[model samples]
Target: MTVGSRRGQATESLRQLTEAVRTESSDGARLVANIADNPICRVTVDTGIPCVVLAWGSYATSAQLRFVHECALDLLRRHALHKILGDDSALAVIPVDDQGWLREDWFPRALEAGLKAAASKCPNGFFGKQSVANVMSGAPVGITVRSFEQLDEAKAWLQTVKI
Candidate 1:
C-alpha cells in the first residue's frame, strides 16, 4: 500500500476508537437530543402499542440509546405514553457504564415522563440478561418493569397493566 493510503487508514482507525471510547462512557446518555429519528429506535404510537423498539448490538450505543430514550420521552410528553414493550434481544454484552447511565439518568426521567409499565422481551444470553436486570432494578415503586421469554407473553402482560 502507498504511504498516503496507510496514513488515511490509520486516521480512520483512530477516529473510530475515539468515538467508541467516548460513547461507552458512563455519562454518555446525557446528550438529550433535540430530535429523535435515529435507526436504533422506533416509536410506535399509531399502532396503540406505546412502544419503543431498540436495535440489538448497535455499534454507536451511546448516541443510539440516548436517541431512543429521547424519542420515547418525546412520545410520552406528547401522547402520555405509559406502557412500553421491549424487544431488545441481543447477543452483545452491554457496557456496565452505559447500563449505569440507563439506570441513573434515564429511568427516573422516564418514570416522570409517563412510563408506568414496561414488559420486556429480555435480551438474549447471560450478559444481556444481567445488564437488563441491573438497569431495571432502579425502577421506583410507582412503575413496573417485567421480563418475559416470549414477545407475545410480554405484550399480553402489558395489556393487563392498568393505564
Candidate 2:
C-alpha cells in the first residue's frame, strides 16, 4: 500500500476499533470493564514485528486493563516475546486509579512475564496525552518505552530494537 493509503487505513482502523467509545448503552461505561461492545481492547501476537500488540478500544476501567494486560502477558510468556505495539490513537483519558493499577500491578507482572519493550501511538487530546504520560511515568526500569504520532513510526522503532 502507498504511504497515504497506509495512513488512511490506520486512521480508519483506529476509528472502527474504537467505535465502542462513542456510543453508549444503559451500561455504557461498564463496557470498558466487560463486553458491552464486541471489543474494547484487542490483544494479539503480531508476527510482522515479532511482538505482541495491545490495541485499546476505549478508556478502559481497572478491570478491563487487567484483562488486556493479562492477555498480553500470556502472549509474551508463551512466545518469549519482549515487544508491544500499543494503538492509543483513539484512547480516552485513563483514570488515576487505573493508572496506579497499571504501574503498581501490571508492569511488574509483565516484566516478570518477559516484556522488554513498549511503543505506543499516543492520543491527540490533552487529557489523553496526560493519561499516557501518567502511566509511562511509572513504567518499570527494564522495559523500554516510546511514543509516536503514527502507527508506522512506532512500528519502525520496534523494528530497530534488535528483538
For residue 113, give model 1's deviation from the true position in Å: 1.2
Off by over 4 Å in 1: 1-39, 50-60
What are the runs in model 2 whose C-alpha is more than 4 Å off?
Answer: 1-37
Clashes of each: 0, 0
Highest lDDT scorer: 2
C-alpha RMSD between model 1 and the true structure:
12.3
Give lDDT per model, in order: 0.65, 0.75
In order of appearance, the predictions have TM-scores of 0.69, 0.74
> lDDT per residue, candidate 2, 10-119, as tens digits?
45743543344434443334443444233567677889889988777766655555555655776788899999999887678888888897899779878877888899
What lDDT does candidate 2 reach at residue 116?
A: 83
Model 1 lDDT per residue over 1-163, tens place: 9868955874575456445544665333332222233233344553456554444434336555555555566577677678778776752456788788777877876887778888878777888788788878888767899999987898888878887
Error of 2 at 9 (Å): 41
Report the poorest 10 consecutive residues by lDDT, candidate 2.
29-38
Give the 10-residue window scoring lowest on summed lDDT in candidate 1: 27-36
